[model samples]
Target: MSDSVFVGIDVSSQTLEVASSSELKTWQVANDAAGLDALVSRLLELGPALTVLEATGGYEFEAACALQAAGLAVAVVNPRTARDFARAMGALAKTDALDAKMLAAFARVLHQHPERERFVKPLADAELQRLQALVLRRRQLVQMITSERQRMRISHVAARPSIERVIEFLKTELGDSEADVAAHVQRHHAELAAALASVPGIGAASVAVLLAELPELGRLDRRRVAALVGVAPLNRDSGQMRGQRSIWGGRADVRRTLYMATLTAVRHNPILKTHYERLLAAGKRKKVALVACMRKLLTMLNAIAKNGSKWDPSLHNA
Candidate 1:
């Protein structure tokens, strides 16, 4: 087998199905700390080029962190892109072992690609991980509060009181979650957070989401940053038939936060307000203008992060 052998592990709630490119071989192990250690040891023994896994929500986190801590090159790919690759290769049938094979092959191609290094983002730092957890908890609390509010409005007289209590409890939790996010950022990522927050129209919530979700914010080019956040316009040209360019997928959490911040920026921030007005006066729809502002805002933030520079409208506008 070549020294540059790619490996894949399809992680489920109970087991990890591992596959390797060296000899197209695979095996299964329990999805636990012991199994993860075993898997890492086995792959290291094989001298892998890299390991790949689809981001199965939180299932892949432990293994990824384990591999990363072990100094292995690991890539947690988007599930949608992995599935599309499987479809392209006529591997439509689904099974853990099969997924392991597909992922191994995907890893091989991904590593060989010119831009492979761009896909190899380091896992979040411990502080960022903690921030991510708090942010996600805040999201859950917000969702629960919303659900309870809806239920309270349409519930029986007795049920209304119970739903209201739940809503109140969730609201309290949400506030605390936000506070934890603030304290964590101040303790660990204060400078980065401050640089981003210095920009007009960006709030604590937006800064928290960016710090937690868009770790690539300052690490890439403006175009890559925008695309990563799902704000870039994608081409849709076929022969001579030009189709509308639209964004489809990226970090939806950061994108959603940016959307709201852009709403405010387009109205108040001098530079962004002018940019928004120009787009609108150019006959672009209000929604399209707003989305462009989102990209512009993100790109500016990316620059600010990269240069360790605080927000300056003059530089950004120019």
Candidate 2:
């Protein structure tokens, strides 16, 4: 057994393919404890230097947790990135063995350091997960209700009593879920939540999104937190194109929440509002000014979290 082998596993609903040192192994086991244990033992024997895996929803989370518990270095990369690489390498035809091989080779060539995966820590409290789940479920239910209502309005026949009953139930569920989120926020993040809520234009829903999505907001530095939320302006330039700065990928939920918050901040938050107005006076586009406000708000939130203080207009002006 090599002391530093690189192992890659292609995980699916009912089975997994393991590859290491250019050798492939297949396993057909239930997505349960026993199956995961067997796979872990086999990989441990190889003493892998790193394990590269892809997100398979909740199915692979347990296996990844098991591997981590056994003191293995594991990193889960975006599945789309992995699949794109597979296609690039001409492994376009999908199969468990082929994916495993592609993943192994991907690991060998890309060699992503495990540190990249260390950023998102698992939720330690069951309550945090429950709160997040409720919030997500509520959002899903709201979208469903909206679509149903649109359908009902368009086709009178579709406005059946059954549809109304489901809509009513969804409304009740959303209310209950929202209440749960509020209670969780008060219990776990009282001061931070209050500080966020006190800001003009920010509301309970946006605060909940921030608490749930950007868990590292308070822990990280201002610039780092802004970038994490995808509000940090990034330069776009090529030899001569020299495009304007723009925001890019990060937590979508945080970015969505910030978008609304930024609109409000430009209108109310004294410092941000003045800065936004100045940009408008300088002939900046409204959208451009608004995005700048979003970055400013994120930076301010990080500072507020770090300092354990509320938003102070005077200090902001200084």
Candidate 3:
């Protein structure tokens, strides 16, 4: 395997570049079926051990999928990590070609394997993705509507009728999207969805987000699920300074929805409520108490998903 060359591909909307241990190849091609075929062919000629690409929105996903289908080992890494590696290598100046070379070099030096995180794919649920996106847009529109309403109270509303119509249309579209998700969930992940909704605060929206983005929750251990959602805190300590652990860097949508749900859970779910009160009585700040509730909620969700059971309050009591 060591004798086999590793290939790094830097993919963009307008160009593609392939680099191996011994040589670099660049191709100017659109990101389409034709370009994808050409790149796969060239990669086949190299017979590289693995191919690496950075996650550029959804720009590289289709191409990566094509390569994977062709029986090539492909990994798409977070672009931030790749860029940081580039800076650490002292290649500050940026160009697509250089980034491609740097990606290959970074892979060789770090031995970073293709992202082990697997998203359930072909996603078979483009409608779920669309529905999730609609929910996000609805949230944004609600914010806009709120802002506009406040503005109307104080001054003249700007294009109020137009904005109102847009909001109404979005709401209607979101309703259809919701129906699509419900239909899909019923057909496939019905049990998981039912188990998730059995929790006190997990609602249709929360369940939808989980199904669309973090469908792997059913397979992950408790702490791992929390960490992936960015609700798990990390130790903040150093040689001379120490700070409290804080949660950071994961899907903001999941984290935010879970935060609100956890708050409601801590208030209404007896098991979580007692736990929340205990933490608060121990002099923990409300924020810290809420985080603990969030962790507990995630643990319960994971347990339910793994065990295929409803939320058990008796077992969950702190």
Candidate 4:
């Protein structure tokens, strides 16, 4: 048998189901510190060419980080991508063990994929991870506050006081989370934050989210960055049958933040505003024009981050 091996791990909150391509062997381990340590040790012996895991809402982070730290190449892929691969390969059944094996096969193919680097990059460092946690906390707090407000509207008069109290507490936590995000950015990412904030419509919250969720913002080219954020329009065509081009999957949180920022930019930021107005004048719908503006704003930010420069309207005007 070839010494080259590929491995896959299906991660869940409680256990990890692991499979290896060389022998088609499978194993189970608790998804905790000791289990991760043991798994790393075993992988070191096998010396797999690549290991793949699906992003199970952050459940796979610890295992992925552990493997990466142990000098193993790891790719954390989207679940949708994994499922598509499974269906294409005729793997209809679903179980932790089966998923792990399918992922092993996916890893074999992914090893030769051109864009594998997109999934195999280094995980965020401690400080940035902390910032991401703070940003996510703030998002949760905001959602709770919004829900409470909605309930308050249709809620009984007797329930109003309780809802209001919960909203107040959530708002307080949101403020604290915002403060933490700000302090962390100031301490670790002040320069990057400042550059992003120089754009007219990008505010502190957006800056934090971008830094936290879209770490590849400055590293990739404009198109790749736009695609990564799910703002890049995709084309569908079959033998001269052209389908409408539309944006598809990418980082939703980053896209949401970018959309909000673009809303403000189309009204205030001179370049984006002009571009938006031109698109509308040319017969584009408001939503379509706004999506274009979002792409433009993202690319502008990408360029700024890449060049380590601030937003200069003069240079961009042409």
Q: Write down the RMSD of all candidates, one decimal each.
A: 1.8, 3.4, 3.3, 1.8
Clashing residue pairs in all predictions, respectively, total 0, 0, 0, 0
> Can you tell me which runs of candidate 3 are displaced by over 4 Å?
1-4, 24-29, 47-49, 108-162
Model 2 Cα shift for residue 9 (angstroms): 2.3
How close is every model to the real structure, measured as TM-score? Answer: 0.95, 0.83, 0.85, 0.95
Local accuracy by lDDT, each model: 0.87, 0.76, 0.75, 0.90
Better of 2 and 4 by TM-score: 4
Q: List the residue pairs that clash in candidate 3.
A: none
Best by lDDT: 4
Model 2 CA lDDT for position 81: 72
- lDDT per residue (tens digit) for residues 129-212 in model 1: 889899999888888888888887788897887787777878888888888989998998899889999998999989999988
Ranking by TM-score: 4, 1, 3, 2
Q: Pairing residues by index, what is the TM-score of model 1?
A: 0.95
Clashes of 4: 0
Candidate 3 at residue 267, lDDT?
Answer: 75
Sorted on lDDT, highest at the top, how do the candidates line up? 4, 1, 2, 3
lDDT over C-alpha atoms for residue 254 of model 3: 78
Evaluate model 3: give its lDDT. Answer: 0.75
Which lDDT tens digits does candidate 3 get at residues 1-318?
A: 567777777888766776777675554556889988988887788777667788886788788888888888776777877898899989999887788888777656545434344211223245566655656665665566677566546754666676567667766765776676677677767888899999998888788777776766768877777877888889899998998889887667778888989978987888889889999899999999999899888888888888899988887763
> Stretches of candidate 4 above 4 Å error?
1-3, 117-122
- Compute the lDDT for candidate 2: 0.76
TM-score of 3: 0.85
Candidate 2, which segments miss by more than 4 Å at Cα? Answer: 1-3, 21-29, 87-91, 105-125, 157-165
Best by TM-score: 4
